[model samples]
Target: GTDFPLDAALMLQEEMKAAFASHEFQEALGALHWATKDLKIAERNKQYRELLLEVQKLIVPRYGFEGTQKGMSLMLMAFQALGYNDDPTVDANTQAMNVLISMDVAGNALAERAAKEQARTSAALKPWEEVPWEVKKVEAP
Candidate 1:
């Protein structure tokens, strides 16, 4: 196996987290974009795969969809990157689909409520309202 540069990648991830914490949106966006492009060499490596999911968990909501549960778009992207589609019964797929459904339902309900009560025309435009989503921790077998 090739020795992937895990240390550098981890450092970059930490830096991106700090940038976001400091409200340095530009840096965070750059980091998220770089991560989407790829931040590792070992796509087949288990550790690298985990890092990819972490990047997705971090990039989403803040930069993509709504709160984590209400937004599995990045998770779907991560699953695709990990080749989870090769198996029809993979729990990730079912879980992701559940999330997509919930996201849609939650979104519609929120938008309806907001429109009726607060005059918000779109729930997708409210990035300021998203909290960090609950992450379901699953260890790879």
Candidate 2:
């Protein structure tokens, strides 16, 4: 028996196949974006996380985040790559969105914050300050 999210996996597979066959890379990417959203909802499930990571590893490379710890999915990573590091300075109003998103009711709050803070720090650092070895290696090509 398979240890995968059978329904979601199969549906995504079929959708990807159809999109690729039709030369609809945009449609395929949209499908992947939704898949990532669904995976986030089921983050407690390791398989779901793996699936999302796999898709991200596959998709982000084409867009040029070839190597980074934060993975290539988040919007911030791309922005950072283009040199939009540093905290977006502004009044408290500008920080509200991030502050709200940063709150974690689960025990993983610290973990979440650490991840976000790390990403922010990484972003703020210039390319020379980035330690390539510190970033997690993508197991996939």
Candidate 3:
């Protein structure tokens, strides 16, 4: 309604605070998206733009594909948590969430495969195969 950018930034900040306090990762991710949108509105030179980008990147995991998909999935989950289905508008939100969930599942599978490939490549380069080092190893005390 009022200057979408400014409104989005304020709303996003509020959402981010609430999500952090409530331990809602999904909501936090959604709030991060709002912050990104706000950055676009405030322009690249804005003081908060860098902070917003930093926060967005902070939530990402080591695996790029997995991180992206997880962030997207969290946003979808947050939308569902916010009772978006109750909105009077079209069923777009609900439909989109379903699609996001499916995509996330597929993405996770792909990431797993990629991780395996990376490990294989590393293992191939290693000289000592006698004492093998696993990619994702479970540490014991």
Candidate 4:
């Protein structure tokens, strides 16, 4: 597992928030809305409440501090928010599949953002052409 620098993680968090405001995110949310349209009121309410808690769980710790445990918890909460469950006997496999797909989408978006930030940072830190390089000579080859 790659450990993103704290700065990179913060940048990713901002990028993800921006993504959530995009039309694509709205469309995805719309799809979720339609999918659950037929659910009983109580069931819908329960799922929505659970989803809210999971989203908060995913966001708070990571934004506050960076660590392997926090990152793992965020990922786990992501899956849960997308409706994953541990019960194999349940017929919610479709929700599990949706979670996997959502994970891929979110992971790719974050990775792309991180890579761009890394590239920008690397370019800024690169030595200017005016700076002379020092080459060490080997006594023997």
Query: What TM-score do all the candidates reach, one by one?
Result: 0.20, 0.23, 0.21, 0.28
- Candidate 3 local lDDT, 1-141, one digit each (tens): 322233333344344343333324433334444444445545623533343334444443321212343564554454456554355432543344334323234345545666899999877854555556784466887
RMSD of each: 22.2, 24.3, 18.0, 19.2
Task: Using TM-score, give the best candidate's number.
Answer: 4
Stretches of model 3 off by over 4 angstroms after superposition: 1-67, 93-141
What's model 4's overall lDDT?
0.49
Model 1 sits at a Cα RMSD from the real structure of 22.2
lDDT of 1 by residue, 1-141 (tens): 212133332333344344333424323333343344443545424433343345445644543344344355544565456554454545543444343323234345445554576644553555645644444445579
lDDT of 2 by residue, 1-141 (tens): 422223433333333343333324333333444444445555534443353344445544444444233643443433445433333432232244233222132214444555899999877978755768657565776
TM-score attained by model 3: 0.21
Compared with the true structure, what per-residue lDDT tens digits does model 4 show for residues 97-124? 3443352354456556668999998778
TM-score of 1: 0.20
lDDT for model 3: 0.43
lDDT of 2: 0.41
Locate the minimum summed-lDDT window of 10 residues in model 3.
58-67
Q: List the global CA lDDT of all models.
A: 0.42, 0.41, 0.43, 0.49
Better of 2 and 4 by TM-score: 4
lDDT of 4 at 97: 31
